[model samples]
Target: MKNTEQFIGKRVLVVGLAKSGMAAAGLLHRLGAEVIVNDARPLEGNEEAATLQALGIEVIGGGHPSDLLERGFDIIVKNPGIPYSNSLITQALERGLRIWTEVELAGLISEASIIAITGSNGKTTTTTLLYHMLNIGKKKPLIAGNIGTVACTVAEKAKNDEVMVLEASSFQLAGTENFKPHIAIFTNLYDAHLDYHGSTTEYLDAKLQVARNQTAEDFLIYNNDQEIVRSSVETMHAQKIPFSTEGKVVEGISADEEWIYWLGEPFISTKEIKLPGRHNLENILAATAAAILTGCKKTAIENVLSSFTGVRHRMQFVREFNGRTIYNDSKATNTLATKSAISSFKQPVILIAGGLERGHSFEELRPHMNNIRTVVAIGETAERFTEFAKSCGVEQSLLATTMEDAVKVAYESSSEDDVILLSPSCASWDQYPSFEIRGDQFIHAVMKL
Candidate 1:
């Protein structure tokens, strides 16, 4: 941590006590900030709150006092999930008080060079792949951000010689002011998280923050196929390294049916990659470009690409049993992702789909159901998926109230050489706390069978 003096004698309020919030509060307190932690949940049984209180930091719980900001804090470090429309946050903005997410703190203190990846999709896969590539290439990389680890937590222990591979979400990036990465990757943008951001423009603006402060010394590996992403970075000072699966870019990276080329030279054979899906081709190109920029050897990148099957809960292949191959893609929480998952295979698929009802139509999914042999629908969107499946000429459509039941029905509906896939096209909040838990249940059910 190089900038410890910045927080000395600062009065900071840490809002919403999740892992990120807790980490921020503790770090701020250690830096000599007068820290106060607050959460809407009651703090009586909250162990995190108790831990902070034990450190002599003030803790407020149950609700936000209307006059909480009147306590005259110098800054607020808010959890990413907390909206700007939040009462305290809105008020803080109106008063011109500095507000940020903990990622800003990560940038301020960390001695490591950051490699940040952000997009509507493919952030996790690209981040994970780059980490593996750098690990094999001996880059001394540390993984952090929205891929489960908190950025500030990882940044605290990071060394100057190391590279921090971060999976940044729009929520996290939105609160960043001076959080610039040494090498940034913009995978691809689509309509997502409009509810929290209020519009597609606002959401895109937040995502673009990943490269906002980069100087000409930095490198930006972006998706040239996405006009929105391509045109948006036109004015950025970072040296742009474009990647595309749709067409060849002589100055950057591109892929054909045979090989992935870098700077107009063949880098690796396409057949060497084990990860499935054409959408992933874009991710592969992006990660490979970043890896090359980070000095990863071609052999190291090839070794990772040939062996990395997939990220867990994101087109992850489970074992083949009873002559049928199963895949868990519970991370497909929207139509676009589900389409990608479905289009990855040519074999007949017994697809388990459906989840939370967001009043969105399944019509967008209709054109991609050519290989869907049977549909096992579950959760709040079950009925709508079932109807959509029938309309697409699927022979069988079954409904289950739970993931386990859905797995059972899907297995029964499958045959030799068929693919049994769980790629729910909706969020998991209607049935489970997160998509990871829902995917775990699917894997467990597959094991039981």
Candidate 2:
């Protein structure tokens, strides 16, 4: 963004008290924007609440005011959860007030060079891997956005020379107009966030925005293995750099056999990469392509890929339960991801699946009959998953009341050759605040058994 233009003195409305909301509010106020912040729920006098009040901003505890439409503001910086078609926000737009996501707003003020990764799956993994590479590459990178920290918070105190690796969600990208990244990655897209996006087309359109505003001088690193991402990217105006397992692109990247190829040059081999599944190898290729785009040496990419530890809650190896290998892959919040996780394992598995349903039905999960021994369903969509598993001809399918119970039952139902896996193909909102907490609890439950 051009530094000559700043929103410091402008009137802005920050919707929601999520991490992005609070960060935007505080930073906007600091930068001279007259901020009015509101959250759907009242703050419980937490540190987050205190931070907002310290910024001298007025807070509407719960709900956006009806007057928000009548009272004019320069811009409405919305949280990702609030649909873009919100009546109040729509009315504000009609009245001539502009709207922006905190993600977009933060991108404008960041001093660090942005390296962003977006996809339905593997975003967090790619983001974490890029951060790990840049973090130890010179100790000059901050991992943020949908995966690590709020981008605004990281930008507020970021060093000018440091690189920022962010995992951008389609929800965050949907309403953005001018958020630019130096090196952008579109990891393999799948059917996800359907509940909010309304359709698969809308969701893919949202993800495409990562490259939509980028110029020819900027770099777009995307997945070649995903047909939709590959096809849709042709319309984008950015200089395209494709990465995939299928084939290498001219002046882009690819994964051939055990090696990670970047710009037609093999930087790292998958045999030495620590991350488990082929899905993660795809993520590494995307990250390596971005890193190589940023002028990091092939050896640097190879060095980091070998040392990078996988993201938490994403197929995290937890513990063994009475000879049963247990994994906490609670971050597999969609059927495609859960399918990838389960397909990676060689053993017949005891799978723990379900949570807050997010419009995901069971078609993608049915083909893994040979690897799955039983599926222990739980949470809101338990019955739906159980029915689907039964239809797939799985002999053992049961529902447990909670993650603790699910772990217990999985331990009981497994043998020495079986893998007890907690790879829930749904959100963790039913029992935990986030996937990390759900994963931690899963590990705790496994240790008990």
Candidate 3:
């Protein structure tokens, strides 16, 4: 880590005790900051709170004390999941106090160059793929951010020779002030997280923060096919590098039906890529462009793209059982994602979907249901999704109470050479703690068959 004196002797208040929060508080305490952590959860049996307390950091738990801000903190390091609408956050804004997510801290302390990837849907896939490409190319790369690891924790131990590839979310980006990446990749933007961001414009603005602080010496690999993303980068200070899977581009990366081209020169053939779906192709193009900027060779990029099937729970191919191909896309928490997954396959699909009822129409999926032979719905949105499926002219629509049952129904409904997929077009919180747990249950059930 860089020997930065910015946090020295500063009074820092860390909001929320999530993984990122704990890491940030610890880092701040070590950086000579007088740190205090406040979490809504009760103090008793709170191991995280206890651990921080042991490190000489004050922990206030159970609830946000009404006058907590009166304690006078220099800056507030907030957990990204905590919305700006939170009372404490709102008051901080009213008080004119600076606020940030841990990504800013990571950027502040890390000696390594950062490669940040952000998008509505493909952040995880692109981050993971780029990390692999860099690793294969013998560039030491550490993976962090929304993919799982806390960015601050990884940045703490990162060496100057290493590259930090972060999967940034809109929530995280919204709180970042000086969090700039050496190379930034904006995969593609779509309508998502409107509830947290309050509007599509706000959400896009937050995602654009990935490159907001970059200078001309930096690089921004963006999706040229997305007009919003394309146009948004026009004012950015970074050297712009465009990637498009749609057609040829004047410069940077482009893909046609046959091959991927960099600077209009052929780089790799599309036939060599093992991962399915056009959405994934977009991810591959973005990752490849970033990898090239990082000096990764074509061999490194090809080795990963030619063999990497998919990220776990993101249209991941599970196994072929009883002449049926199974895929676990439990990460498809919205209709746009499900639509991409459904369009990835040409075989007849027995789809298991449905989750939290966000009160949004599934009508966006109607045009992509031609290959959907059967629909097994579950969770709070089950009934509504089943009805929507029937309306889409899918011959068989059934409701299942459990993941196992859904898998059973889908498998039974499938024919030889058919695809059985779990692509819930809603959040997993209706039945599972997270999409990962929902995906694990689906995978376990599939393995049992």
Per-residue alpha-carbon lDDT of model 2 for 157-253, expressed as tens digits?
7777888888889888885888998888998777767878899999999998888878888888888777888899998778888877776665777
Tens digit of lDDT per residue, candidate 3, span 1-449? 88668789999999998899999999999899999999999999999999999998999999888899999999999999999999999999999999999999999899899999999889999998999999999999999998868999999999999999999999999999988899999988888789899999999999999999999999999999989999999999999999888788768898988999989888899999988888999999999999999999989999999889889999998998979989999999988999999999888999999999989889999999989999999999999999999999999999999999999889888899999999999999989999999999999999988
For each candidate, what is the lDDT? 0.93, 0.80, 0.93
Clashes of 3: 0
Greater TM-score among 1 and 2 belongs to: 1
Candidate 3 differs from the real structure by a C-alpha RMSD in angstroms, to one decimal, of 1.5
Better-scoring candidate (lDDT), 2 or 3: 3
The alpha-carbon lDDT assigned to residue 412 of candidate 1 equals 89
Pairs of residues clashing in candidate 1: none
**TM-score to native of every candidate shown:** 0.97, 0.88, 0.96
Q: Model 1 TM-score?
A: 0.97
* Shift of residue 236 alpha carbon in model 3, Å: 0.3
